[model samples]
Target: MHLPPKQGAAFDPLSEAFARDPYPAYAALRATAQPVYYAPFDIWLLSRYADVQAAALNPLSLRSLDHLMSADEMAEERRAQNWHDMPFHARFVQFSMLNADGEVHQRLRKLVFREFTPGQIERLKTGVATYVGGLFDRLGGPFDFIEDLAAHVPGLAIGRFLGVPDEDCPQLRGWSDDIVQYFDIDRTDARKALAERTTKTFYDYLTDLSKHRRRHPKDDLISRLIARWDTGELSEDEYISTCMLILMAGHGSTIDALGNGLTALLRFPDQRLMLSADRTLMPTAIQEMFRYDAPLPFFHRYASEDMEINGWELPKSTKIGLLYGSANRDPEAFADADTFDITRTPNRHLAFAAGPHFCLGNHLARLNMEAVFSQLLDRYPRIEPVTEPVFKPGLSLRGPKSLPIAVR
Candidate 1:
């Protein structure tokens, strides 16, 4: 398959070189008929800021996830390779708000939104504090930040949300890693099979936890979901899928953000120092980090009808991947778009996508990030990188796989 030029070459998403450093290629794309088309992937790449924003704004024209495909798109993209795969588990993404559209999307989102009420999120700070406290005590110099710290933040946070005990949070992290590979780059039959099995195990565990909660409800997300299910707003299938969605999407990107954001902070000591001097800048600093190194670079969408983007005509049902990563760094969107600046105002980065499919967990994710960075900056006067970071490959969600650093 054609891939982004390895090293400092053309933009190819499938190459390890691009995965390590994609910005140069993305920049090259920005300087051309970008996001126009990729012969290998057989999908349009929407890299321009306006086009990516347009896709997210017009979800009706460009869909997210399965929304199940309306039977027509499914028949068309059976390989599911074109952004509408359903082979793993029927309706696997069925109840997921990420995969729904219109009324169904609204309904699913409302159910979730209510559960994440402002009051509920505020109360979440206690658990977050506790997890961060424990994690900080054990972190020290000469450590793999991605594995030792960044990876655990989301796991512990989600564990508290899912009511998994502290001890089991580590195991849950493992299950999360194995199962989330369903969205990984280049899935072999072996990888797919392993992911399915891992997912089933994770799903079954949650199902049992859900059943137990039904018998004796608690103040956890699963219980809240069960409560909604009992009220007839959610089906058992929806209940299961929604729980999985929260467990996966909820924590996954935050972990990635922490890795990507912190790496950028370390690489740009000036910006990191600026944020340290003025804690109020934390919020904006995080925003800049997102724009600088978007956790996930692109979002997937299937063309709902014939449409034109940046002068390119896209036929109905065509697969499209919106390049938010590139857009965040587009010169037209941000002055010195490639530079890492925490003080950047009006930083409208598409790290979290936008419109109806705008990240539902944005508030929680921001809170978690702020909390983690606060602890890190406070504890370590210097977060020194011992080695170069490595990235996990995918057109979507991108982050460092390993970031070894020295904390002092």
Candidate 2:
């Protein structure tokens, strides 16, 4: 009997060192020239840009294995993953527009797809700008960029879009953080309890909010979803799940992107100076930032059928982890993958994973980054980091934990 070499042995995602710099490990994984089998998770990790892209574009590469697994099998798998006990997390977070495939994915996606279209998201630009501007107006001295600024914008922007009260946005942020933390590799019992508790609380809040929308429909995502539910187009679980998905997906990810972008600018002052000189590079710079440090880096897919990828044959039900952060920094994909160039052309980065499940809130996330970075450049002539930024330690998410910046 032969054993599968643990190629992922060096990849310790839970370590603080990895959080500070995972690119080195990612590079090593990609150098192996084949998918690395991580025995701990029983999954093959795809690190190269081409491999990740292939897996993402392959229809057989599914987000959820429920389609192929039987009820008992799924239950057993969930139990193995410690994902069985949480009823609310299983209902809402486990099965969502994000995890569904085929017709089911399309149907759930279309329900709120229009709300995220460029034009629709564009409408909220003015509001986001106003909100971010107000935040800057109140800050007169040095502050933690993550907690003080980046943390505030995404929640309010997404909250307003969902018709969540501005006052409740802070609480929503807390709920989102707690729930999202459990999605990472470290699923401790404490984290699991927090995730379930927050999920239930969030579900309850959305339940009450949906009731209000039912009584008096408003011009918000929740109201629109409620209308769909009333028309038999959506189930009660789907409605709540969709709302929770939107808030959770958009809130923390955007905040991380904002912080990562700022940290990039501060670290590569030359790039920041170039952006200041040529404001037109903001869009490309935003893309570069996402590529440089993708907030949501590790996403998994299960093979629905046998598939050949990067010279390796994967059997049915095989789990493949797509390292988006690593792909973005792959040298073959970008001329100078490691360099943070604001003006890099033809940057087809997978910061937002490609194919059917490409991030729905991508446009909104970009708009938020543009508004915040643009304001930072316009409002303050000199911005400097007060201390070394410490990134949130996780494989699932990437961003500085806090970034204290002095602005004038």
Report per-prediction Cα RMSD to one decimal.
Answer: 3.8, 1.7
Across 261-346, the per-residue lDDT of candidate 1 in tens digits comes to: 98899889998999888999998998987888888787677777766665666667667778888999989989999889888998
- After TM-score superposition, what is the CA distance of residue 383 in candidate 2 from its true location, in Å? 1.3
Error of 1 at 237 (Å): 0.9
lDDT of 2 by residue, 56-96 (tens): 99888999988889999999998888898999998999989
Best by TM-score: 2
What lDDT is reached at residue 357 by model 1?
A: 84
TM-score of structure candidate 1? 0.91
The C-alpha local distance difference test score for the whole of candidate 1 amounts to 0.75
